[model samples]
Target chain A: MTLKKKQLIECQSLWKIFGQKAKTAMQAVKERNLTKEQVHNEFDCIVGVQNATFSVDEGEIFCIMGLSGSGKSTLIRHINRLIEPTSGEIFIDGENINNLNQTELREIRSSKIGMVFQNMALLPHKNVRENVAFALELRGIDKKSRDKVANETLETVELSGWGDRYPDELSGGMQQRVGLARAIAANPQILLMDEPFSALDPLIRRQLQDQFIELSQIMHKTTIFITHDLDEAIRIGQRIAIMKDGMLVQIGEPEDIVTDPVDDYVAKFVSGISNLHLVTAGKIMQSIAEYEASAGPVKEESLLKAKLDDDLDCLIDLSIKTDEPILIESESKIVGIVSKKTLLAGIQGHWNT
Target chain B: MADEVKFSILDPFSAIDIGIADWADGIKEWATNNREAIQPVKNYLNDVIIWMNDVLQALPPLITIACIAIISLQFAGKKVTGIVVICLVAIGFLDPRAWDLTMTTLSIVVTSVLISAIIGLPLGILAGKSDRFEQLIRPILDTMQTIPAFVYLVPVVMLVGIGNVSGVLVTIVFALPPLVRLTSLGIRQVNPSIVEAAKAFGASPSQILCKVELPLSAPSIMAGLNQTIMLALSMVVIASMIAVKGLGNEVLRAMGRLDAGKAIVGGAGIVLLAIVLDRITESFGLSKREKGVRHWWESGPIGLFYNQYKKLN
Candidate 1:
């Protein structure tokens, strides 16, 4: 998507170091990016996040994908001041949050930003209703009203009637749903989820992801999602950013990133994604009547389409004569056609040419 | 017939008396030799002795009932129970003469318990946080716990000489082991995952202690406190010997004159106090079972605790 909406949250040149001399070394940081070894040596610091800059527009599902220690969680945490950026400016809705006082920061935490952690991190001692209303309570909502909203939030997450149950009573997926409801119950402007579904089973993870997709459409809350799963970033994120070490290597729409990766790290991630069943007909369909005809008749739609598993041998279908424009049929008639050369080139991203 | 004339007379001294003197002499000799190695234990004993003497000399009678009742309500929450009320009322009935003496005895107990908590809590923290501290304290705690209540007095007498101070000292010495050790054990037993979670939540050290550590480990600490108080109570007669006033002296006096009724009533009263206090302490221990100190959703979550939660709501 284009940058059509107003930006809600932005980070510029963020840095974090973990030692007594962090202040001194941070003073010496001149360039935009610092090497891990240099950071470690200068201050005996563990560089948690480095020079990270990104702006999440209102209502956008922005994802930061990285492996463990890629600093994605730390970077996201900077938004809420959960882990204060060592030396950077985080602006929420055009206001620089670096100087927000304790009370102001707490207000922001309760009313503006909500988060979901990897372990679900639900207060185990409380039941679903209590947990759902927990942050709301922190913000000072009355019991009757908070309970009403908590129940509604629970219903939104498809967890209605489960509110009376405690965290221990729910399964991993259910607990995460509770976490989701908790985050959204306060009706915050932005939601930050750091691998919230990482602990659930695969089936449950997919289910929750789908729910998020539905909810994001209806809820329309700006969300920053963090995950290591590339496909997840593709399926759920409108725009996905890939990170390695502590730097953003690439960021783009899911298909654009998958079909045309920025570098080897992203390419490696793209190649392993097998959920090709989700690719639309519009993405792969082509016109095949442009080339020379062969002996046998092949459908235009068939010639234009090739599965990810299909090789060049698939062009040997009798529907088309040798050396003719490749063709394939759809419901009733021949559709667009293409030659093997053109098809291969398109798969190789020659469409731009 | 001439030799039998003297033998027929009753022997003046009993064999049991001879054995008691030998045991006392042996302990004194051993204590002198091992005094240096046992300096910490000795210091602890001295502190207990001094504090107990002060309390035994100062505490009043009616206040003892109030202490028991207050503690009982907090602990068991069964305020208005007949037995508890009866126990409270009985203190008032202890013939007007017994009133001041009862409180004198009580003042020593309550104060020593307060001191025990102050001292034992830190020691328990040390023991809980460090394996080496625990190892170092194990034998000493074991000795304190295992030694008879009466035995504490002998050591108290040796160190501070006979008086209320020595009596109170012996009570504290015998009672503190449980509280210190259990507090350590309970804190150590709290779930590490929860502690880590609290840290991730931006909880400061003080907040973690007040919110997570103490609330979670309350049961064990209360258990320790309860044990300590009961042990302090047991030291009464032994304490009375050191001039600490209380029912112990009444029992001892009655015994001297073979006054069976006074002895029975005094002993029964002490037993009643023990039951009342023990129930109250166990009630306080129930705090551990209270919902996780986190907010509940209904009345604007009870925030991290009762106070902040109230403010938030």
Candidate 2:
């Protein structure tokens, strides 16, 4: 799905080192290959982001996951230019955002992009409707029109009657929905959500995540979502990028990251997540020729069939229905086979053919 | 012999004098020479004080008391309204002269608070927005707050001479600092995330100040105004030394004649006025949610008439 759409946002070699000597530290990082700690010790600078590069296609939800201080939040702020990059280039819809003047940058922020914060930073003084209509008010839209749009957006978030209530009067989950409504009310093409659901209880978090996923699908907003939870990333992300100490360790599909992590850091994060739904048959299946050579030729009529993209749980169900190994097909041709042993191994985090 | 007996190797450093007193004298001369340039300001202040005093004195005491009761009922509820009404009646009964004197005092307090707000709010906002401006004003505010009112009173008398205008000027100098400091503090204390959200939504600096920061920090600003009003009341009494007339002058005259009964009456009147003003201004700081939700026409004297109209219809 991502292959066909145009790239809506792109970051190239982004670096953000926080300190007075950031320029010197950036120079040292470039010329002498200084590490994060080395730069801090030598130049009194903390590397906020280092050499980060990625792009989000239109209507894609790209999740950047990491522990705290891993620069995921810092990285997301660059998209809206809330925190200017120490050294790098950012392009939004093929325009170099760094080159925009203050007015032009604000124009894009108000009209082209919207952000949802983790803290649900709704203005406490304004009622929910006014808070949701804030961006429109900033654009000098009349109160009558902005309020109407705000009410409609409130309905979208299932907060129809909550327009008159102050933010402090709402529950954590409802406040977050208000935050989400505030962002989408502006109807910006791009959405930058920084841990929007991270502050809620487990039940509310899951509920909001589900609602957000549904909303994203309907809205078709190109999103850059930041989270520390790998489960959330696997649940919502079309592609996940794992960050560590201001660097992107690996970026790939959820299944790829789960089945084949680039390094131990990513492997550690993936270990905690269940692979039942993330691991696909194509990742664990053996070639049909190799499978036939090992055993005898497989009978097509007796075999249970599964798509190549089918997850481990589906393949397991197919294997249970029939005593034969599951046939993995791409289009009409059988590309691979997933037997019970391979399915069990796949669940155990093994991808041996 | 005393000089020879000095065992110290060094003498006190007295090679030159900085002549701060001389510079002050020069400034005094400049001020005296420029009094004509400042006559219009003094005249304007005198006219405003006289006009406000006339307006307050012209209203019947019962009408004034009723207005206060209605205002207190609207903002502070029934208990405060009762206390305020009782206090006003007590002052009037204690001394019939207290009523007219209280009006004079109220006029000065109101005018001073208004002028302080006008000067302090913008300066405070400027300090809030820029660290350099805050730094520049911090020492000035500290001097205004910490320096004795008596110290500045001399220059004030020299410049504006002795009258209600100088009294108002001195009261402003004394009352202005807290409002400025509290306003700056309030702006600084606003949640940073809220500010960031405003920025993210592409709010201009001025828009952010007006739409978000100002509204959120209103409670603190009101607190500042309360402080300013209280300070202005206290300073207006001290300003009586400069021949400023009012309830303060009554107290001063009683002290000179050693008339203890008269002093008690004047002191009681000032205290009553202070309590009433404090309660009224302090109520302004309470958030609307805490004050309970009510439409504008549903409280005060307006509410009384509205209910009557509703019943009639």
Q: lDDT score of model 2?
A: 0.91
TM-score winner among the candidates?
Answer: 2
Q: Stretches of candidate 2 above 4 Å error? A: A1-3, A292-301, B1-19, B294-313
Question: Model 1, range B237-277, lDDT digits (tens) per residue?
Answer: 77787777788888888888999988987787687767766
Badly placed stretches (over 4 Å) of model 1 are A1-3, A28-34, A275-353, B1-214, B220-224, B227-242, B247-313
Instruction: Note the DockQ of each predicted structure.
Output: 0.09, 0.80
Instruction: Please tell me which predicted candidate would have the highest lDDT against the true structure.
Output: 2
lDDT of 2 at B115: 97
What lDDT does candidate 1 reach at residue A63?
95
